[model samples]
Every structure is written in structure tokens, then in C-alpha cells.
Target: MRIDRRQLLTTLSVTAAFGGLIPVIGQAAGSRDPRLIVIVLRGALDGLTAVPPIGDPDYASLRGDLAVDKAAALPLNDLFGLHPSLVNLARQYHAGQATILHACASPYRDRSHFDGQDVLESGYSVPGHTESGWLNRFLETLPAEQKVGSKGLGIGSTTPLIMRGPADVLGWAPSTLRAADPDLAPRLMDLYTKSDPALASLLDEAIKTGKIASGQTPITAMGGAGDPKTMVAMAEGTARLLTAADGPRVAALAFEGWDTHAREAQRLTQLLTGFDNALGAFETTLGPVWNQTAILVVTEFGRTAAVNGTQGTDHGTATMAFLTGGAVKGGRVIADWPGLKAAQLYQGRDLTPTTDLRAVAKGLMAELYDTSSSALARRVFPDSAGVAPMRGLIV
Candidate 1:
């Protein structure tokens, strides 16, 4: 049942022959659906901080001094409240353009962030040896012709392992350089291939598209600045690229600095602000195509339900995943109802996860690419047959 490198590549080719690649071109005479964007928030965002529980009887006591005032929280519903810093997303939610999945996490139960991320991205129950991510696997399932053009894109200094696979892929990092140096691109490609075969193949594809050697100015030069702002600008750039006629179909964007172990208020606010801006950029840039796109914002897991002695939260269980875009069936918080009671908490420390994050991901993949849950479980997220893909996530 284990997939090796070569077999994995072959599987991609076969999958591409059937499943359609994303970032699909112009709306067909009868076709309307288009693209999907995935944003991964690293460092395990504290869902309780981002979206507080204003209705939970024990919420204030559990969060202690770190709890945000009801006045400061943007009311999503009478029960669930959003951090004031997420005004942008809050507006989207109120407008029926965003939805939240609460008390959710990857099947992995261990506390290691690295392993948790691996399980989250690799779409596997266990870590240490997943070869491809569920997104890439979804790409593989697309029709061969649909798979044509640039492969998946990774934004940031390093390509996430989630987006790495046999499929042609590309990497873009916002830099201060005015433009890509024609000579430097091929040299860099050579270096990558020599150092890492996987990255080499990816770079080769990027170069062939003339995207790498186009001498295009760095995205940062186009007004991108600062930590979270820079990240949002990166996402804006990604949305622009994905919407292009000749641009990539699938893309992966990662935002760091969500680990709020201390100074939860200030740090979480900044992180959520950055996320809000990034999402706003995507919505604004996508324009009319926005309705055709679906953006899934997810994290490795949630932090402890109760604030710790450090004035922040620690890695624990459960969390929230956001689905936004024109295509999302929004204006609702999706969950299996795991309460925040002390006895209800996982290990009596974290919010007990009631919904499997994989189901949400699978639901999106199924709707966007016409892939089935069976394939998702068998090839994309192995041993997840017990987890059915949730429906009604797409408009």
C-alpha cells in the first residue's frame, strides 16, 4: 500500500488523465467553476484567540486574563465571536462569503508541530514518510490535458513539502530584487536540480514557462512590505498569477508566526491582521473570478483551550479552518459540536476535535476537481476511508 517515488510519479500521470487540473481557463459555455487557493497557517493558530467562544459558560474562566472583551470581539453569531483584528474576515462571514470549521484537526494526535504539519499537509494519519500531498494527489487525478501548463506554485522562501511531488511545480518568493536575472534563473535551476532532483524538475518547468527567466520584478517591489503584510502581498501576487490565462492552476501559500505562546493578545492580533489582509487581497484581486474560486485557510492544529502561565496558549488539539471565496457555501460555522467543558477537552487541556480536518479538505477537492472520496482516501490520504468527505461546502 506504500507508494514509492517512481510509483508516485506514475500515479500522478494516471490521475492527471482523469481529474482536471485547477485554475481552469475561461468559463465554458456551460462551465462556470474555476480555481482553488490553499493557505496554510503554520505554528498552530490559537482558534480560541482568533475566534473566541463568547457563549461558552466556562470560556472566560478558561481563557482567564487573556480573554478578549465581548466589545473587542466581532460577533460572528451569538455564540461564536471573532477577534476584532479579523474585521476583514468578519465582514466576509457576515456577508455570507466565509465559513468556519471549529474543533477540527488532522488525525495525528501527537504534539510535535513538525509531525502535526506533516500529517496536515501530507493528508496522512501518521508522519515521517508521506511522499506527496493531498493537493498534488488531487492534481494527479485531473485529466492529462487539464494538467497542462505550469504546475502547482509554492509561495515563500522554500517550497512546502505538501506541494512537492512528481508533477511539474514552481516556487516564488518575494524578494527585493527588481527583476529576475535571466542568467541567474538557469544557474539557480541548475543548482537546485544538482542539489535536489525534486526541486530541479520543478525549476525546469518554471524556466520553460519563461516565468522564471522573464526578468519579472520581485513582488515585493510592487509595494509588498513587512512581515504579515509582505505575506499578504505574496498571496495577492499568487491570486493574480492563478487568475492569469497562462498562469498556474493550483497554488499553495504559507504564513508563519501564528505560534502565540506569549503575549497572545498582541501577537495573535498581528497574525490575524496579516491573514485578514491576505484574504482581502485575494478577494479584491480575483474580481469576478472570485466567485469561481475557493480559498481554504487551515492550520496544523489549535492551541490549548485554556491560556497558559505564559499569557499564551500551547499546542493542543482541535482548531478552526476557514473556507472563503465566491464558491464557498458560507455564513455558517461548521462543527461536530465538541464543547469546551473541562471534561470535554482532549487530554483535559485542549478543545476536543469533533470533526476531521481531512473531511473538509476532501469535500473541497471533490467539488473543485470532481475527484471521489475513495481516491482521496486510497491515494491522497491513505487509510482515511472511515472519514467521509463533508458535502455542501461549495456554492
Candidate 2:
């Protein structure tokens, strides 16, 4: 007499079933239809290795064996170079479509991954306050009419906290199984329509999003969400959805498996390669829309300045954030250049953060949505009104 949610899902899988389906309406575009994407790279990224400061005298000595050879790295300028595995990013940089923000971090100073990510995505000065995320809050600040449509999108098995809040958001993840019967979806919809209108309404939206996601590679096909191999597939699917006429204007995605406490050289290579390919997918699939979009790639924190006993770096402070896409004022590395010398290091172990990650995020939001500084400080970032948004980031 009673039906379980899992059973309903299993039966629906015969046609097309989704992980998490939420109703999200679409909005009419104004004169300037700007798109923004936030890609959170989970696990600490070694900022020193990813964007090696080859020009810094202490860089080579401090990094030692983990040092990125300047000759092999893609030169960004006279001082900094991107890791060799970032081939596509390097190309984007050279084409004047990429910019790097070095020595950056969230307000949180502790090293707990769980807490650090919470603070980073939650857009708060401290961790443990997870009722809503900054991006979702930003969506709440949009004009009331904009809320009628697809304002915020979450792509993955579940919505990341960064995209969770009072605002409605569309959720999409490619189906992992083949449809057993093409007719099953409609049949179930009819049954739900008669027996339960609530479920039927949800099913309708699911079917709609499923159609939007049709022809995309499943997460399993690409080796799961956290697997490096899945990056391109995930990115391509995201582009497909974003390119849709009625798709969301802003989106959030998270990639995992970046905590490299050991075997970093080999691991980092694979990760960076996957990331490079994903960047290529976004640039290629977005077409003309790419010119109006900006992608922000960030991590929870950076790793230690020196390599550990296991040839990897430990958790520390101050990492790098990437700003890429045609909308960005590219070909620049923004940093206060905290030297790696012991005296300059944070706690004498990690790179010192000079730029607030929130400032960069706020600046982007300010430009893209024309959000006022007071609104950003009050509703989006919350507290710390003294922090000014970094300028010259957007074209």
C-alpha cells in the first residue's frame, strides 16, 4: 500500500530517471545577457605548482624537486608560468582569454577540508554557517521578474552548497542507465497525473530536464563525477545546458579528488590534463556565447610551500584562483607576490594570502549583475564590508 521513493525512482528508470530534479523557470534576456560559472576544485590545490612563480628567487629552492621547470611550463609573463599539463589553459592565456589570481584564499584560516569548503562556498567570514550559499543568495537579489525563470543551475549528482538556498535552481545529471522503454516515461506521467498531481508536476520537470540532457555522456561512462576522466564530459554537458535558449544564466559545479598529500607529481599531471580538456570543451561548445561568459576556477586552499616526505605537499594557506573566458581581461597574473622566503610565509610554512578571494568574486558579481557594493556586503558575502571588489577583471 505504501510506495518508497527508491522504488518510484527504480520504476521510472525504465524510461529516464534523474538524480535530483527541481523546478526552475527560464528568464528573458535583456540587452546584455552575461553568463557566469563558478567551478570549485575540491581538495587543496598546490598553487605553487599549478602556477609556478619561476621568477621568484626562493621558488626553486623552496619547491625543490617539486619545482615546475620554467622551460617546460607555459610562460604567462616574465615571472609566472602555468604547469605543463595545462595546455589548453596556456593556449587560452596566450590568446588573451585567461587571467590568474595568485596567493588568494577565503576568510577561513584553518586547514580542515570540510570547514574550509564550507566557508569557501557559503560565502561567509567563517565556517559552520551553511544555511545558504553566496551564489544562491546572489540569485535572491536578482529582480523579482528574473526569479520567474532559470536564474541558477546546479550540475552534478547533488546540488553543491554553493548553489543551495531560498532561490529555485535547476538540477541536472546525465542518466546512468539506458532507457528500457521509450513509452514508460509518458505512461508513468499519466499514472502520476491521475493518482498524484504533486509527483506528476515533478515528473514533468524531470522529463523536461532529461530531454535537455539527452545525448550527453553519463557520469559512469566517464568514470564517475570525482574521476579526472569525467571532467570533459561533465563540462560538455554543462555547456550543452547553458547553451540552451531557456537555460540558466548562472551555474555552479564542483570537481573533487584534488587532495594530493602524496604522489602529487603524477596525480597533479592527470588532474591538470583533465582540467585543461574541460576548459577546451567549454570554449568550444559555448560558441558565440563564450564571448559573454566568465568562468571562475577556485580551490579550498593551497598546499605547503615545501614538498613533504611523500613527495607531495601538505595543507596550508593562500592558493590561486583562475579567471578565464572571452569576457575576462586576460593575459595577466594578479598577485601581491608574497615571497616564499621563511619571513614572508604564513606561519613560516605556507604562502601568505594578499588578496581576498571574496573580493574577486564580488568584483565579478558587481560587473555581471551590476550588484551594488552594499548589496554584496549585506546579502551575498555577508559582513566584512571593508573588503573592496578587485577591479580590471572583466572586459
Candidate 3:
């Protein structure tokens, strides 16, 4: 009973926090007042499915069962089409508030979700290269005069490693955390192990679970750590906090469950809906500050181009990047157009990455915050001198 009650409380806290009840404290926006939101899709998102390359002669054939039906895809251009689930994003694109960056990826190419996410967030050419996040370092680059002497407010339980550099960063999560007691974790884990064995095994994972399983319902049913409503509400809270004239100007959000190893068609469709809705919520909540904002959506890596036997995809390479907000130079599917033929595949299985994600980041930071590419390579993204910022990312 103790375990069950604890689990219930845990879920309740998430409900309350995500429902916009908690006010997260963060670094006040600097003098520039430019807001940047980085939403990390932890699981390997299949770029092909999210932003389908229908015009590529090999796309449909290579994708097999995992391919999004071009006829149903929302037309983005003569070449690419977005999945129906991303209706909000497509609308933003039409309004010139979004841009689709195809065949983009971080330097990490391995399939491990942990490592991929680390590389994606850490902004390193290799994993474990930095103790801090690129965003944190980006914040460090801001003129001391504009910094406003603030730290970041992470939206989840433990502060993520990327945000852990020299700069101070605070964290916020759904919790009933009373006065900090050293024995809390151990006691909770002990109780959880004795009560709910399944939930106990993933104590850390529990902190991020979108929904708790009951009865015969599988835990796998929850799309990511966040459910659609929770994600939307989280966005609402973010907008509220960020829109504050004195609120933190930068934030980091992570959403998982892109690992569609099976039944990807069904799974991805649902996840995409969540993604679309979250973006919509941000737009609605940001209000006047929307014009000064730039939201960058990126994934660790993309899934294979070819569908597996179970109508899903394996971890591959090269996916799409999404940017939306009033500050972005939108209505363009930016790419070097790597053909999806077998010979063109990264390893003869994945889409070939044509652009570096760091370059995109460089462009945004340089353009929005008046950051320079030289400084971006030197300070923000260490050893990223050769990779030039993809120009024209910001208006």
C-alpha cells in the first residue's frame, strides 16, 4: 500500500507540474530578450518518417512498410511532405514561421540513445568532450552586461549533464520534495522495490514517465516520458516563464520514445501528434515574446531508410531538424539534397547526413544573440572551427 500510494503521489506531482501549477525559476532574459527553446527528442527519431522525402525516387521503395503515404502527407514542396500528424508545424511553415532542415545530424553516429543524446546536447564532435551543454556555454558567451546574472531552470528531475558546465543551472521537476532529506531516495527506492517491482526497476525513468501503467496495460504504451497533455502543459509553463520580462531567457526540454523499433507507423503517428501539439501550445502561450523567440527541435540521430520485418526501422543516420518561431527564417526545407539511393546511404542503409547540426546552432546563436561564428567555434562549441554556421537561419 505504501508503494502504491507513493506511485500515485508521483504521478500526481507530474500532473500538477505539467498542468502549469509550478513556477520554475530561471535566468532572466538578458537585455536582448531573445528566447531560445531547445527540445531534444531523446529516442532516435526517424527523420524519413517525420519529414518524408517523397520526391526521392528511392524513398518510397527503400522505406517499404515504414514509409508515410505520400498521398496523405501534408505537402511541403514538390520534393518533401510532412507526416499528417505534424499539422501545426506545417501551418507554421506556410506562415513562414518554420524551416525544415533535412539530412542533418550531430557528429555521433552510433545507435545508443544515451550516447547519441549526449553528443547532441553536449555539442561535441565526440562524446564526453564537454562537461557543459552548448546552450549553457552559449549563455556563457553572452556579454556579461547582458547576462542578467541568472542560471538555467531545467524542466525535469535531475539536471541533465549537458547543462552542467561552469555556469550555474537550476532544475525543476514534478515532486513532493519536502525539505531535502538525504534518505529520501533510498527510502523511496526500497519501498518501491517491495511494492511495485516494475516501476522500481526504472526509478530514474519513472521521474519522466508520461503515464503509470495499471493492470494489464503495458508500460510501453506511454509514448515517451511525457504524455501529450503533460508535454503541452509543460510547454505552457515554459511559455509563461519565458514570456516574463524578468524570466529566464533560455530553457531545455527533453521528450523521449522515438525508438520505434516496432509498429512504427502507429507509434510515430501518435508521437508526431504530441510533437505538433507541443509546438502549437508554445506558440499560443508565448504571446508578445513569440516574435523574439527561436525554437530548435533536434534528434540524436535518424532511423534506417529501409523498413525492418516488423514494419519499423532500426537506428540509422542523418535525419531532419526543425526550427520554428517568429525569429526564424521560415518556409524553406534547407538541404544539400542527398539522394536516398542504396549507394547514397550512409552505410547503405541510412539517409546520408549533408549538414551538421552544430552549424545550424551556430547560425541561430550568431544571428539572434549577436554571437560570432569565431566565438561559437572557440567557446560555445569547442573545436568546431571547420564547421561553418549554416547561414540565413535567422531573419
Candidate 4:
């Protein structure tokens, strides 16, 4: 009954269900009606390889086996180029629907995946300081009667901690989601029912909420969640829901399997391919709404700059973040471009982070939701008073 954090996530990753949505019955339109999606690539992503700085003198030397050939890359301006796996993203860049944020990191500096994700999603300067997520808090700050509804959604097998809080959230994952252990659920519940009542109660609530989500509207999203093979289906299903005028207006999703400490060249290719395909599905499935939406793709952290003995990158600091969709002011690679020199690296190994991701996120939040800077700092991202929201990200 006392499940470890890792075990709990492993279990939830398989058994996905839903909770009720506070119906947005008459989805009124306005500047605030714009769509925004936050995609958290759970595992660390190699910023150098994904958006190579072909112009940097040290890039090729540091990357070695993992270096992408600029000749086959998709040109993004004269310096950075998109990885070949990012074919769809390349086309998006050309169409002015994409922007990449380089050398970015959350406040968390260590290489622990769990802690890094904790700070990234929780919106705190340090990990483990807060229990609720920033997104959930942002939802809580909405004017009680203004526009609260199913517009807030989390799509995956289990909702990311970022989407868990007071907000009335709707969940979507593949209906075929199976349990990690057929008897695990019952056994856990029984153990909880007798000993840890609080934990047991939460499990009960999730189950009941899942049932409440049944029969209202079909889980039309093809892929459901979590399974990599169904990535496109997940994107299509997300778009299907977002397109419904009365359905969700803002959503967040998480994709896994990015921890590429070995066979990175081949591993990253498949991951990027899924990412590209998902982007295409969003454009195709959302139809006209695609123009009004901006998708934010981020990872917990970036891998090391130098390739290891295994020809893969290890955990490091500073990576890339992406913003794409019709709402974005695209055709730009925004980065101070911290040099790859030994002195330039953070602690002499990873890329030194030059941008605080909170600023970029605050900027987009203000543009789409018109949430004030004061409120953004005080409510949405507490203790982040000095980190000003960025400008010119959305038009």
C-alpha cells in the first residue's frame, strides 16, 4: 500500500482514466479565447542536436558522433538549423509558425530528472517547495465566473503534476489503457482503505472522476496517451477536443522516452519524428483553430554538450524550448547563444543557460489570457516578482 514515487508513476502510466469537466456551455469568444498548449518532453533533450548551432566553431568538435550534418539540416536563418528529423518543424519554420528558444533552463540546476521536472512544472524557484503546480494555480486565479470550464485539459495516461490542483480538469488517454498489474489496483485500494485513508481517498476520487468522464463525449482522440506508438493519435485526439467550440480551450500534454544516454543518434531521430508527426496532426485536426493556438514544447533539462563514450549525451544543463502555431511570431531562433567553449559551459560541462523559461512562459500567458504582470507573479508564479514577462512572442 505504501507505493514509492517511481512505482506510483509506473502504475499510473498504464491505467489512465478521466475526471469530469466543468462544462463550458456557451464558450464565449474574445481575445482571451485564444488557444495555448504546453508540451513537457519529460526526459532530458539535447538542445545542441535538436537545434544545432551550425555556425558555432565548437559545436562540431564537442558533438562529434552526435553532430548533425548541416548540409542535410533545415536552415533556420544562417546559424541554427533544424535536425533532419524535424522535417515538419522545418516546414513550420519556413511558414512562420515556429520559434525556438535556445540555451534555456528552469531555476533547478542539478541533473536529477525528478527534481528538475518538479521545479519545471511546479513553477517554483527550487524543487519540492510547492505541492500544487503552477498551471493549476493559474487556473485557480481565473475570475470565478469569467470563463471557467472544460477549457483546461490534461492529456496522457496520468495527468502530469503540473495539471493537478483546484482547477476542474478533463483527462484523455487511450481507452485501451491497461493496468500495470491487474490486481494492483484492488490490493492497493484495500490496503489504503484499512491504513492510509488519505491516499486511499485520493485514489477513490480519481476512480469516481474517471467514471464521471464516461459517456459524456466519446474519447475521440485516437492515441489516448503515454504510449509512443500512439503519439499521432494523441495529437489528433487533442485537436479534436480543442476544435470543439464548447470543449477545452487550453491544454497541456507530456511525452516520455527522451532520456537518451545511449544510442542517442538513432533514439533522438525516432523521438523527433514522433514530435514532427504530432505537430502535423495538430495542424490537420484542429482545422481553423490551429491558427489561434500556440504550442509550447519544453523539456525538464538538456543533456551534456560533449558526447560520452557511448556516443550519447549525459544529463546536463541548458537546452532548447519551442513555440509553434499560428499565434506565434515565428521565423526566429531567440537565444543569446552561449558559446560552447569550456569556460562558457555551466560548471564547465553543459551549455550555460542564458534565459529563464519563466519569462517566456509569462509572456505567452499574458498575450493569450491578458493576465497582468503583477497577478502573474503574485498568483501564477509566486516569488517570481522580478522575472518580467517577455515581449513580442505572440502577435
By lDDT, the best candidate is 2
lDDT (0-100) at residue 91 of candidate 3?
Answer: 96
Which runs in model 4 stand beyond 4 Å of their true positions? 1-22, 25-32, 148-151, 178-227
lDDT of 4 by residue, 193-311 (tens): 89877777656544433433332333433443334556776677677667665566777888888888999998889888988898998888888888888999989999998989988
Which candidate do you rate higher for lDDT, 1 or 4? 4
Clashes of each: 11, 4, 3, 5
Q: What is the TM-score of each candidate against the true structure?
A: 0.84, 0.91, 0.81, 0.83
lDDT of 2 by residue, 158-203 (tens): 7789998888666665555554365776797899899988778766
Deviation in angstroms for 369 in model 2?
0.9
| Residue-wise C-alpha lDDT for candidate 1, range 1-395, written one tens digit per residue | 23454344332221111111233322212364467878888889988878787887888888888887888889888788888988878888888889988888899887898999899998878897557777777677665545544377766555666787766555555553444444665576577678878855534444443332122333435323327867676766677667666667677878887888888888877778878988898888777878888889889988988777889888888898899988888999887767778789999899988899889988988777677777888988889999999898988
Q: What are the runs in model 3 whose C-alpha is more than 4 Å off?
A: 1-32, 174-224
RMSD of each: 6.7, 3.4, 8.6, 6.1
In model 3, which residue pairs have backbone atoms overlapping below 3 Å? Answer: 27-248, 133-162, 210-225
Compute the lDDT of residue 247 as modeled in candidate 4: 65
TM-score of 3: 0.81
- What's the residue-level lDDT of 75 in candidate 4? 89
Q: Model 1 scores what on Cα lDDT?
A: 0.73
How should the candidates be ordered by lDDT, best one leading?
Answer: 2, 4, 3, 1
Off by over 4 Å in 1: 1-30, 148-150, 176-217, 221-226
Q: Sorted by TM-score, highest first, which candidate order results? A: 2, 1, 4, 3
